[model samples]
Target: MTKSLVGYGPIRQTRVGVSSSRGFDSESLGYHVGQTLGYGGERVYGRLDVDYDNKGGKFDSKGNRISPDVNQTDQQDTESLSVNGSLGVELTDSQRLDLAVTYYKDEQNTDYGPDYGDGLAVLFGAKPSLKAIDGANVENEPYTEKSSVNLSYSDDDFVGSGSSLNLTGYYRDEKGRFYPSGKTAGTQASEVWQANGLTDTATLKKLASAATFVTQSEADIEVMGLRAAMQTETEVAGKKTLLSYGADFERENSEQTYYGQDLNTFLASNGLTAQTNGLTYNGGPDTTIDKWGAFVNADMDITDKWHTSAGVRYQKLKSETDTFTPIYEQLLEEYFNSPAISGISAAYGIDYQAGDVEKGSTDHDKTLFNLGTSYQITPNDQVFANFSQGFTTADIQRALRDVRAGFVVNSDNVQPITTNNYEFGWQGKHGDTAARLSGFYNESDKVVRFTDDYTVEVVDTDERIYGVEGSLSHDISDKWQVGGSVAYTRGQYDKDGDWLELDAVRLTPLKGTAFAQYQFDEGSNIRLQALAIGGDDKAFKDQQKDPDASALPVTGYMTLDVLGQVKMPVGRVDYGVYNLLNKDYLTVYHQTTYGDLNRLPASGTTYGLSYTVDY
Candidate 1:
């Protein structure tokens, strides 16, 4: 009974590798197995991979090992595994069906280690007690789990000559547990004054004496989608053409749950009524999103040297979130409105009466379009341009977390982001060299940004980015070849109509890369590459808000790398030395999480070696 399905024997391979690095310490081990076999004259393949990577430690300019910052990999200190397989079969002469399934898990431990933060505010004439929610964020393991299943069917003659239809269904689920980032800048000496507007030494000490804690977060989502598409070769304008249309429906139920623990004293220090259960609260609402869309596109050859394509899509989206009253906000409102507690609040510059909890839902129906064309200027040169539109909503949980009681969430705060993109590019080859160049401009009506404290910034306005990029490769000779690429971009968003620049996360948009390779006669080659990142000091400091709380300046730096592969008795051994120049530079991440204290530097130099062969 077991011998009939497989028409041929299985082909299998196994891979094993181990790597370690210093400066910024990291160690990893990997093992993988893959197999392909014939099932009834068709092929089916499956793969399994297991990996363990412990990424920790940072370095200073002097190459001294140091503790990583909160922005770095807190504890990727565990093992991850994944398994996937695919199968395909022919249902008829013109019909086919395919199925695939995947599963992955990454579970790891976090050693929060004895709460540390007392010495941070020493420069401000105080010692702040910084603990991770009194150790709640500590002594816990975090993990990510994901699984997916996909099935597809296609028929070339479903509607007769020159017509086809394809259908697909997919389902996926993802779950994750994450630890707290770190205590806010208020606990750090440099950002103490910015946290509390008070400048007096006495009040500074009072602010520092307050105990601060962190939060723990968890989220999960299950999504299912179905799609149907049809294509037919037809003459729309008496020209050779193809038209395609598709409709898709996607529904996902996602929920985010956030909880934190803090002392009752901490609440009282901020003029908020102490919660009966402390500061533990659901930071946002549980949410579900339903979306469906349909699109039609056409491709036409207007002439021998010109081509054009265009499409439009209609989308219907609805998001619903549960109503939840934050414990801390409720406690604050209680304290503020109570005449009995007025004196306690007035001592801290009491504000007006805070209102009840806020929550709402948002829905949208819109149509989007995309257009593109290309014209050939010569056999080896052509230029193309396109315009496209994208639409989506901001993070619902974040919007719920930062809601104002009196404002309407559905109408104002929780709005969809609509982005418009324009791009033009040229591709060509001259002699033994080939080149490509492109420029693009993009604008989004709404975007989200985060500060070091994990507080959310709902842009809700316009974010515009424009950039130009180009790459060139030349065969200097048969044995020597060189290529390089460079790109520059400028990004800014409207904050209350005052356009502000983007920060380091992705906005450090100037970069250049160059590589040169030397080939040996036996198909072995060694390549050298260099990367240069331009400094960005304008965006972070240009606003002139609070010096200590803002991101630090990033200086330009360059690093070189060498890679080569040599054939041996067993297999082709691939080796590489990264950061060959050993340039010591601080990562943009180290500065963006929080300011000036305990910044992390990049790795000095790293090496890697691996080999693979068919059996």
Candidate 2:
């Protein structure tokens, strides 16, 4: 068995009217164990793990608003325990088979001030209004139970030529539960507010008090998948060649049960009726999805100094709903006036049907391809280039719902977002030094993005991102090594077009990292590293309103980290500190919600220690 202890702390200082603080006293404990057993040509491996952690610190809230306490505490505690075992068998000298099964249960609880919920509410408008709710004590409890089985087989005697066949399969079941505190419930109200535009904040406040406060609910999901592949090696045109083919299938089913005073009961107690205020009660629905695909690839060497590879894949996806819960329609008629609700209705194109509604299942199919080549430029240098195409299917989230509801139109039957990528790169080595450089360009069609109201939509316009990245490393002596990497990227929408979310924030245009490490004898080592990120200032709707805001000027920042280690008879101990310079900056923005980049304050310095051993 192995055991460990961990701790972290943060200190913050605001230079420009932003919230900041300083403190520590956070920690965690973890333990794990593993063993092996053997019988003839078969081997079995088993392992167990347990862990607990708690974090406490303070920082600014939304929009750079400083908190009142210099030492506010936000704590998260988690406990996870799992056990797994696997068996491997040697069917022959050149063939093998393996099978594994695992069962895991994890429970986590988080308690923090209103900052957590408030931040989410402000950005997505997805929560109940805090103005009408009490937040002195707020907590979120989420837990998951999961079990899985895995199997694999491999064989290598196909017709005497070097060839192999492999097969793998997996099945998993997951059950989860979530509890919403008063603060979380309030966030739900915010979501409704943005969806319906019923700006009666006071009415929402009152509804907040009477709403069905779900202290807890249960969500369950099950998934199964299988993959099989074959590969062969042969001589072609006096050069070695490899060919591979594969197929895969996957399926998932999910159900969510809401437990609490049903919506009708709560509304009746509050002297409300479906007709009295246009209120309606709808529950959660059950969902199911099925996906399957097949693919093939080939690699051939035309000459000793040149090689090429190619691949293609085809996939199909289908989704359907077993039931419909009209929570949205109920809330709209009850609280929002008919006109306001109608506008939203027209925007999303939702049509209400009285009887059991079966949303027609959606079907999608796609194909992807790739090609690549490599050449040796010199004895110590090589160059390569590749072009590839890829796609990802959409999910049943708010975006998809809006697409189905007719609030938005994608015109492509919600086809998968597709990307074509091209890259050329080189690598070389010179004695004790090594270097690599690459440039890449990616073009995406049917780009999907979220709208200001949290609805999903696909833009007809295209998007392009191109960049260059390079890295180098050198060994100055037997005891010391140094390395660095730099990258520059440019991303933009096509000319004369704009994407609500992408247009409002800046992606990291330039980023670089440098590091140095020294080995002081065999027992000790030390290392230091630094990172810099830069981006052009971004402009948002709110910032655009301010003539003096300078269109959200581009921001730049840097951070540093240091680490040390000492070897012991049983294990090695490691210590490290991160964000040594504590630079404050915002790393991302969700323009659809908050209308500005959520500023991520510089994390204060944190130090921790860990130990590892090999039997």
Candidate 3:
């Protein structure tokens, strides 16, 4: 919401608001302002915004809390700032140049209490006993800064009559730091005690008094790109047609640095030579990616009621990764030479041989195509069908790290994934009513799957997924309106044997939302909404073939919410109550790398109020 300053014409607009919700110790504040200046054939605009958030922790079903428990600070707090500016110049009648720039910074400090492990034990039936400790304090502080600038030039008749050309160039940089406290130290203690089969209370207490494990890390990313596009109107067999094409190239650089401890070597240096050995993580790595893409499409009227379009895109990607050898490898070699540890490793089929950092490069090239047709039954209604192919590389971050026991690369060969998608839909509007229905079928090859294991491994496989979605809305009168929407999805893995329901891939098969609203004569309105999420338990139980391997099912839940606004002379009052009924449900449920179940519970009831003025 915004309000204009008096006597400033269209040059000044300002906005401000305050919001409060349950579980937070303090309210949030936001402010924004924009200004514009215009002269002969030129205009410039700029905007500045700031947001401050004070996050209050949440409560579980038992009324226990898991918020920051630090001694002196707001456990979960965030501050963000954004600035944007644009300049436009009318070089000539049909030619123009525009330049824009944006900068954003987000900084957050978060703390966690001890009760964090309660839900994990109860819901997942497994505990990170080594990592979760009583009286242990956990904190995460991350700061991100980003900025971008773009320049564009356009000409209406550069390529002849009824033709236009546009070109753009841009560059962006993002830098951040990821620092965690207390977590690594706690886990190290747990692993050491377990590996040594130690249960003596006095010994355990003495070990706990040792130094905590901590790491310092930093990340930097940079991107630069350029694009050019042209559009023209022409006649194809006497039918007017539009042809559009574009080409783009981008380069990105990513780097990460980490500093940590080596448990075995550190303890041995302190006269504790008999202590069990455990590896640690430490290093700095970098990856560079270059991508090039080009696409062309044609839109033409086949008949009075029918239209068709065809397009194809050619994409090429090249990536190179470089890693530094960490301290863990050296420690592993030492352990291998010791007779005591060597026997244990040999019995377990363990290989302590470490390889040098796998510095290498990979490339991917693909040509994707799209075809579609639409038929207009009336001026306000239409039905369309589309088929398309797409290609995407695996997660870059995942490619850089191995969660395997030795933190080794899981595989030496990596490949891109491809998807084939088919879709059809119908959309129509009649009077005060509107509706839509759509269905889609998609198959993907070489999809990445992370197995539920302590040391995670990335696997590739084929899969098919299909879904349908629909929505309808109608206005009963000038003062009342109602609308609702629903979606359903199903998926299967293309295994060597019989196809199985994609167990590793968690998807809620059915979900829906409905709402009703009342509008007053003076631009004021209130809305009530209901949302339903279907349980995955029933579907899993029926589809799972192996009883021993099946996981706990996800339960279904429904919630209610309300939103309203009141119009005043110079401003509007806005408010909302989320989860009005305080429904208890899990928003997400899945297995973690350690084979432990993980769940994120939905928030309890929360309310917020804010005001905006247009002065």
Q: TM-scores for all candidates?
A: 0.81, 0.71, 0.77
**How well is each residue in 1-615 modelled by candidate 2, as lDDT tens digits?**
101101111211111111112234332222233333323322322233323223223332221222111011112234555656555666675666677777776665433223323223432345422221222222224566889988888778755556788889999999975433211233444455556564677766654443323223466788999999999887767677788998999888776653433333323322111111122233334656778889988899887778899899897777665545433433333323344344544554433333333444667778989999999878899999999987665555333333222232232454566789999999999999999999999888764555443345555568777889999999999899999999987665542444322333334547899999999887789899988877554434434532322224455667788888888777677777666655455443411123322332434555556665544
lDDT of 1 at 387: 99
Estimate the lDDT of model 3.
Answer: 0.61
Worst 10 residues of 3 by lDDT: 268-277
Measured by C-alpha RMSD in angstroms, how accurate is candidate 1?
6.3
Lowest lDDT block of 10, candidate 2: 1-10
How much is the lDDT of residue 149 in candidate 3? 92
- TM-score of candidate 2 against the unseen true structure: 0.71
What RMSD does model 2 have? 9.7
lDDT by residue (tens digit), candidate 3, 540-596: 564456332343455667899999999988778888888888776755342211233
> In candidate 1, how many Å is residue 500 off?
3.4
lDDT of 1 by residue, 257-331 (tens): 645534333233321111122334555677778888999999999999999999999988888777675433544
Return whichever of 1 and 2 wins on lDDT.
1
The segments of candidate 2 whose C-alpha lies over 4 angstroms from its true place after superposition are 1-22, 26-75, 82-84, 100-106, 115-140, 144-147, 158-162, 173-221, 254-287, 333-358, 402-412, 494-509, 538-554, 582-602
lDDT pick, better of 1 and 3: 1
